[model samples]
Target: MWQFLKTWYHRLASPKWFYHTSGRWLPYLAAVTILLLVSGAIWGLGFAPEDARQGNSYRIIYIHVPVSVLALVGYYLMAVAGAIALIWKIKLADMVMVSAAPLGAVLTFLALLTGSIWGKPTWGTYWEWDARITSMLVLLFLYLGVLALSRAFTSRDTAYKACAILSLVGTVNIPIIYKSVDWWYTLHQPATIKLTGGSTIHPAMFKPLLVMIIGFYCFYALVLILNTRAEILRREQRSAWVRELI
Candidate 1:
């Protein structure tokens, strides 16, 4: 078992091996992602009950909650991939980290936009400098910084190293973003979906929210795999395998 695990781990460290493995999983991941997203969207948009307070506007939770969660998870993933790339000099790891950045930025933007939309109906305003919201904005900026820094250097090796360091440094912002609501009194409500305290939200609303979160996670995996594959192709363009495949 140990030998098997080590072999698999070492295999993944190779760009070609990682590319082929990811390719095998891509179709399955994509199919599941689409299935979950469509199912969740239909359920959330069509069947979920209207909020007693916010009415139809609360329906945006389907997109808002999932994207917000992904913003944090995505950053962590990029940082971890960066760490792996730096430590092992694994081309696949660097590619995964690079591919993750734009997607993370987009998710952060969606979260902020949807939050604004949800806010107008509930808070009677489209924007506020609340702790949660402010921290989220900062998180978005961090994503941009990593993306920019990664492309700034003339040498790819130097670029990857610089981006890796920046990614590690930026990880500090994630905890700040997560705990901002707890540390500061904010207009944004405390977690409605708590594990131990019992969810403040009704079960009807909660169900679709869970489904949507899962769907969004699946979607991220799908995109990440596809993007990683593309990066592999580009990086290995000179290789016999890539040339033959192309």
Candidate 2:
């Protein structure tokens, strides 16, 4: 079993092999993402019960919470990809990191926008300088910085290294974003649904929240796969495999 696993791992380390394997999963992931997102949106927006405090306005949580969560996760993914590219000199890893940046930025922007919309009704204001919100804004800027720096250099190698370093440095902001509410006084509420401890939200709201979270993950997977495939094609355009596939 160990030998077989090691062989498979080595195969996956090859860009051509990884591309072919990813191709097999792409359609399925895309389909599942669409299905889950549509279903979750319909259920959450139309069928879910209104919040006791915020009423119908809280329905935005379906979008806001999911995007917010994905923004953080996406950054970590980009950072890990950057590290792998820098340490192992994997060209594909660098491509993945580069491809992930724009998507992460979009997600972060959506989170901030939706949060602002949600806030107007709940907090009686469109924006606040709360720690979590401020940290997320910083995260958005970090993502932009990585993207900008990656393209700033004429040499792809130099650009990749610079972006990787930026990603690693930006990772510090993620923890600050997560712990902002806990570590400091802030208007943003504490986590309502605790995975290990206890949940403050009732089961009715919790169910849709879970569904939306799953839907968001599926959406991210779908987008990442598409973006990564495009990156591979762009970077490997002159390669025999890409030529043959194209």
Candidate 3:
């Protein structure tokens, strides 16, 4: 099993191997992503019981929570990819890192946007400089910084190195973001979904939320694979395999 796993890891590090393999999996992945997102949206928005306090306005949690969770997760993935590229000098890792930056930025933006929308009703304000909100805003800027650095250099290697260093440095903020509400007085609510202690949300609402989270995971993976494939092609355009595949 270890041998098989090691072999697959090496295979996954290969650009041509990933491009062809991911292409075959795209259709099935897209199908599952669409199914989960649509069903989860319908269930959460239309069928789930209303929040006693916020009423139907709470329905936005279906989108807000999932994207928020994945935005954090995506940054972790990006930083890990950057680390791998920097340490192992893996070209495919650089591709994955580059592909993840914009997607993470967009997801972070959506999380902030949805949080603002949710806040107006709950907090009586559209925005606040509270700890959680402020930290999340910093997260968005970190993503933007990585994106900008990735494009700032003329040499691809230099750009990748710069982005990788920035990504690694930015990871320090993630834990702060997670713990912001706990560490300070904040309007942003403490996490209701706990991995170790189980969730505080009612089962009726939590069920669709769980589905939406899973759906967002799939969506993130689908988009990442698609973006990485494009990046692989762009970087490998002069290679014989890419030319023939094209």
Q: Of the candidates shown, which would achieve the greatest lDDT relative to the real structure?
A: 3
Q: Compared to the true structure, candidate 2 yields what TM-score?
A: 0.95
Ranking by lDDT: 3, 2, 1
Which window of 10 residues has the lowest lDDT sum in candidate 2?
Answer: 9-18
lDDT value, candidate 3, whole model: 0.94
Q: Please estimate how well model 1 matches the true structure, expressed as its whole-model Cα lDDT.
A: 0.89
Q: Per-residue alpha-carbon lDDT of model 2 for 1-246, expressed as tens digits?
A: 999999986786677887888999988888888888888888888988888778899899889889999999999999999999999898888988998899999999999999999899889998999999999999999999999998899999999999999999999999899888889877998877766898888787778778889988988888887888887787788999988985
Instruction: After superposing candidate 3 on the true structure, give the runs of residues whose Cα lies further than 4 Å from its correct spot.
Output: 1-6
- List the candidates' TM-scores in order: 0.96, 0.95, 0.97
Question: Which tens-of-lDDT digit does each residue in 71-145 have in candidate 1?
Answer: 999999999999999998988889999999989999999999999989987999889999999989998998999
Clashing residue pairs in candidate 2 (N, C-alpha, C atoms within 3 angstroms): none
**Candidate 3, 87-195: lDDT as tens digits:** 9999999999999999999999999999999999898999999998888899999999999998899999899999999999999999998888889966988898988
Clashes of each: 0, 0, 0
Model 1 off-target regions past 4 Å? none
Instruction: Rate residue 15 of model 1 by lDDT.
Output: 77
TM-score of 1: 0.96
List lDDT for all candidates, in order.
0.89, 0.89, 0.94
